[model samples]
Each structure stands twice: as C-alpha cells, then as structure tokens.
Target: MDSSSPAQGAARSADLAALDVRITGCRACPRLVAWREEVAATKRAAFADQTYWGRPVPGFGPPDAPLLVVGLAPAAHGGNRTGRMFTGDRSGDVLYAALHDIGLASRGTSVRADDGLELYGVRVTSPVHCAPPANKPTPGERDTCRPWLVRELGLLRPTLRAVVVLGAFGWQAALPALTEAGWAVPRPRPAFAHGARVTLVRRPEPDAPGTGPASAELFGCFHVSQRNTFTGRLTPAMLRQVLATAAESAGLPTRSPWTS
Candidate 1:
C-alpha cells in the first residue's frame, strides 16, 4: 500500500492506537521489565496503597498534532505509577505548568491519566517507553526500542511539522527515527544545545509514497527534570520561549486559543 494514501493514513492512525496498547504490554528488555515490576511490587511509602501501571508507558495527545514533544523515558515512580508520560512527578509539574502558561495545555497539572487535561496542537512521547534503572536506559535497550518510535513517526508524519526534544538523549534518539521516517538528516548531524534548531526536508519513500516533500523543524530544550528546574538551569520562561518558536515554525498560532 502506498503509505501516503488517505486510506493508508487512516489505517496508520488506527495502527497508532493499537501501537499504544502494544507499548503498554511490551517486555522487550529483561532489565527494564524486571526493574519496572520490582518497583511496582516494592511500592513507595507514599503510593503503597495504589496499584502501579508497572509497564511501558504510551505516548499521549492527538495523533495529528503538529508539535511532538519527546522525553527520555518514563520516571520510575512517576509514569511507572500513574501510567502517563510526565504525570505524577515534579518534572511533570514544571512541564504542564509551562505548557499551560504557553496555552498548549488545558491545565497546569497532570496528576493522573484521567485528569481531564488536554493539549493543543501537541503530543508527548518518549524515546524509551519503559522506565529504566537509575533513570537511564542502556544503549542496547535504546536500540531495541527504536522500532516503536520509527513506526510512530511514520504514522505521525503527515501533520507532524515540528519536534521539541527535551534533552540530549531525546535529541539523539529522535534524529535517527526522523531519518528512518524519511526526513533528510543533515550530515555531521546537528549538535544538541538548549536552544538548538534545525530544519529538515522530508523525502518521499519508495515503499511509502507520500505527497511529495515537506519540511519540518526541530527544537531543543532542556528536560523539565527537577535537577534542572530546581537548580535554575531550565526556567519556565526558557522552556516557553523554545515552545513558542516551535509553535511558530509549525504554523500554529503563537498565542494559544485560551490565552489573550
């Protein structure tokens, strides 16, 4: 099937939903599987009575969103417990707050999956779905998890015009996936910096013929981790500035619908 066909795009949208289900069931890496489950079983004192998701976390937001936000992975007690990316953690507090301030999020906090928070023109995902030990996924684990992201980008390609990578890790992971998904990655690859920006032209694939070529932009921002936020290395203003640039590049309204 030509990947660019409307029928195919619809099928891909359904596949993306199916992929989310599959992501929540993945036990691809023995280490990640063990760690996630072990943490779930040993429940933290504060959340001892709650049942943890204890599985890979899936991407959240509209599939046709123009802005895609990529993070490193789920937090051990955060997403691992709440089952939503950037939910139930301090990092999430900072991220959602910034998103709200910039008019991307409907609310300033995301405590649970059913919190009724909504995103405008944006989606959030991660390079590695499963939370890893010490908050770090090994190179082998990252490579093993690449296919899911590759498939996700393929499904999101039509409307995806800009990407906001949270950190260097996400920046590294997204580059290859974008390339595999048909974006012409520049040689020497763009370096990762807090405010880095790169524009790549999409190339039509023989196997997945699309409507000619399209251009997309990539923006870099420091992760909304407590380590960075608490230390003042990544202020909310800084984060909003990068997102504002991305939103403009994606042809989205700079001011959110709810904002003045």
Candidate 2:
C-alpha cells in the first residue's frame, strides 16, 4: 500500500514472530502438554482436527500498556481451542463487554485473535498458559510456569503501572514474582474477595533477584470463569468496581468508562 504501511507491517510481523517463538517452544510443564494433547485428540470431532494450540498463550496488549489484566489460566475449549486469550468462551464474553464499556477494547468480540479485536492501554494474559485439567492447575505446574510470567511482566516493566488479577489463583501465582522483584506483598496475601488493591513502592533490593524496586500495584477480584459469570458471582457492576479500584490504585480517574 503506502510507504509507511510496509514498515508497520514489518514491525507487526517481528513482534508476532517473537510471540510464536515463545508459544511453540514452551515446555515449562510436560504434564500440561500431555493432558492438553490428550484432550485435543479425544475431542477431535469437536475441534474438527483444527488442533489445539497446546502451548503457552502470550498476553495480548500494547507493549507500553499501563494496565495488565491477569486471568487464572486458559479455558480448555476457549483459549486452547481458539488460540487467543479469553476467546470462544463465556468468560471472554463477560470480559470483553466490560472492557468495551471501559474503553479498553477496540472491538466488542474476541472469538479469535484475527477477529479484529484489540486492547488499548491494557494487556490480558493468564498465569498458567495452558488450559489445566478441570480448569485446576497443580501447584507444581503453576510454580513451573512462573518464570515465563516473570519475564513477560519484566519486559513490560516501566509501563506496567497496575495489574488486575481476575481470580485468587492468579493473584497467588503473581505474588512470588512481585515479591521476588522486591515489590510489597499484600498484607493478608491475595485472597478471593473482590476490589482489593495493594500498592508497593519500587526500590532496589539486593536480596530481590530478577526485579527492581520499581513500585507496582495489585488488584484482586474473583475469576470471570464460567462458574463466576453464570452464577452471578461476577456481575458487570462487580467487575467495574474492581477495575475502578485498580485504575484508582494506579492514580487513574475512578469513573468507569463502561456500563455494567
């Protein structure tokens, strides 16, 4: 098309290529791979042989986004099937709606990555990349998967103003990384109650490896899983409250951009 178009395309290509490298070669946990593969093979008809991503799903958002949305893990038939965060599922439906209302989503739907959806000023990722059995990941598996999460957050360091954990487990998984980086731990730790905000000032700590004393904030909420969304545990108003708290924690205006 235009001169600048080619350059833009090249930059996008390089970024996606790097994401592919991380996804395809990820072997942080063998059990996760085996379980997902088994699920993929046994449920072949449902997927029409399209194949499962069966790998780590990287976070989706702008590189310099100031906000990070963290989910617990991928959904077996959702992200694992569609190869995108919070896509092809109910959890995604609720999340996207809220995001759109809040002015974070560039689109209303996210059935697939190519669905022309984009996130502005925000990134979405899961602590455990692969879909876990019964949607529950073993502590060992979560531990093994921590390094990638650490690296991803580090890369987004300066711009990562605040993180909104979608569930208790997500908060738990993120705790070690933040602490290791010399960030403050939540007083009572990351519990499942919604709208909790913990802010830590960043400072250099020789004892803390792989993280600077860069201050960060953590927001807690219930997971937007099927159980939570369908059972009314996480209503649109509830999610908005959580988001507002997170934004406020990061010194953003407290008004919600989206309607519940």
Candidate 3:
C-alpha cells in the first residue's frame, strides 16, 4: 500500500506541512541569510519587478511519498525567487521534464509555485534550503541546515521506500541525514555514481511492531544542472532510466519511460 490508515496518513500530512512552514522561516546561517535576502532585494534583471521568496525553500510533494529526490540547494534566481524547489530554474526544467516523461509528474514544465504541477509518489528536496552566493553551500552551512532534512526523512520514514540523490554533494549530505533519521548507512559509505543503487536498512523494533518498511533503496544520479544536461553528460534517456528505475523500486506506478 502507498500509505497507512487514513488517520495516520492525515496526521503525517499535517506534520509535514507544519515542517515546511518552519523551514521557510529558518535563518540559521548568517551568510546564507544575507545572500538570499540581498539577491531578493537587488533582484535579477528579468525578475526585477517580481517579488522573491527571499527565504529558504522547502521540499515539495505528497507527504506519503514513496520516493525522495535530494538535490544540492536552491538556485539563486530559481527557487530563491519562486519560493518552490526547482521552480523557475533550468535545473528544474530538466528534472521535471524527465519526471513527466516517466509518468511521475502531472506536467513537464514548472515556472511558478502556482503552476499546478504535481508529483506522484515522489518528493523533491535539498540538503541546503537557501541559495548560496555561488550555487555552492559551505560544509558548515550544509551541516547547520541538516536538521530539516533529518526531520523530513523522519516524517517520510513511514512511506519512503527509495531515494534518488542528485550529485555527490547531495549524496554525502543525505546519507548522514538519513542515518540520523533512523536509516542505517553502510560502513565506508557509498560513493555517488550515476545509476548506482544502495539499499539502507533499519532493524525492526521489538517494542514497536509494524511501524513502516524495514529497508529503503537509494539511487544516485548526476545533478540535472545546465552543465550536465547541456553537455550531454546526463542525457534525457539516461535521466529517464534512473528515474524510472527508482520510481519502480519505490512501488510507484510506471509506464515505459522510453519513447521511440
């Protein structure tokens, strides 16, 4: 089953919603705080008239998602302006388009938070919520913002069966957060490589029986940044293969992702 009893599902949904609200208000890192706000205030030339989200961007998708996609962070003008992960960004463009091709998304394009795009059985989040000065978050900043990912994994522990981490940065970041959230990380920790798969485990609790799944698989994929996509380092077919595999691993519905 995709979720637990309706009551339990509702409770978790509420908790996830609450968590997202808290994420938006967080200003834990001073550097990140100044950068995000400064960008929002100065504004990009194309978006000069638009109001920026100017704060942390939270995860987006169903509370009972069976799969999670972890990325590095929000784009300076993308999620930072739109207030939605992957929205108004080139990276988001490739990711969502592949998602739609694999039949996991309602639409292939997402321009704004109000664009009505939706994901089925999948959630997208980042280790760092705030956009960094040069699209890179310091190790200190990543560690500081980790509590949010840890909390999100805890809430989704009941239903999340697999994860697809984009880039080495997210892979490294997510492993620790997942471990902190109750999933076991393999000793010597798995390294990131496109299409790599690792299944993390959880010991069944004798005290609390029948909580959630006992194990979850993690998949690695190249970041869908313009650098990767534009250079064909991560082709659309390659992306479709990884996403389709991860979606099926999570027990989500799927059709063949290839279109001749």
Best by TM-score: 3
All candidates in order of TM-score, best leading: 3, 1, 2
Which pairs of residues have clashing backbones in candidate 2? 101-258, 202-213, 202-214, 202-215, 203-213
How many residue pairs clash per model? 0, 5, 0
Any idea what lDDT model 1 has?
0.85
The TM-score values for the models, in the order shown, are 0.91, 0.82, 0.93
| Steric clash count of candidate 1 | 0
Model 1 sits at a Cα RMSD from the real structure of 5.0
Q: Model 1: which ten-residue window has the lowest total lDDT?
A: 1-10
- Candidate 2, which ten residues in sequence have the lowest lDDT sum? 1-10
- Residue 220 lDDT, candidate 2, scale 0-100: 83
Best by lDDT: 3
Residue 175 alpha-carbon offset, candidate 2, angstroms: 0.8
TM-score of 1: 0.91
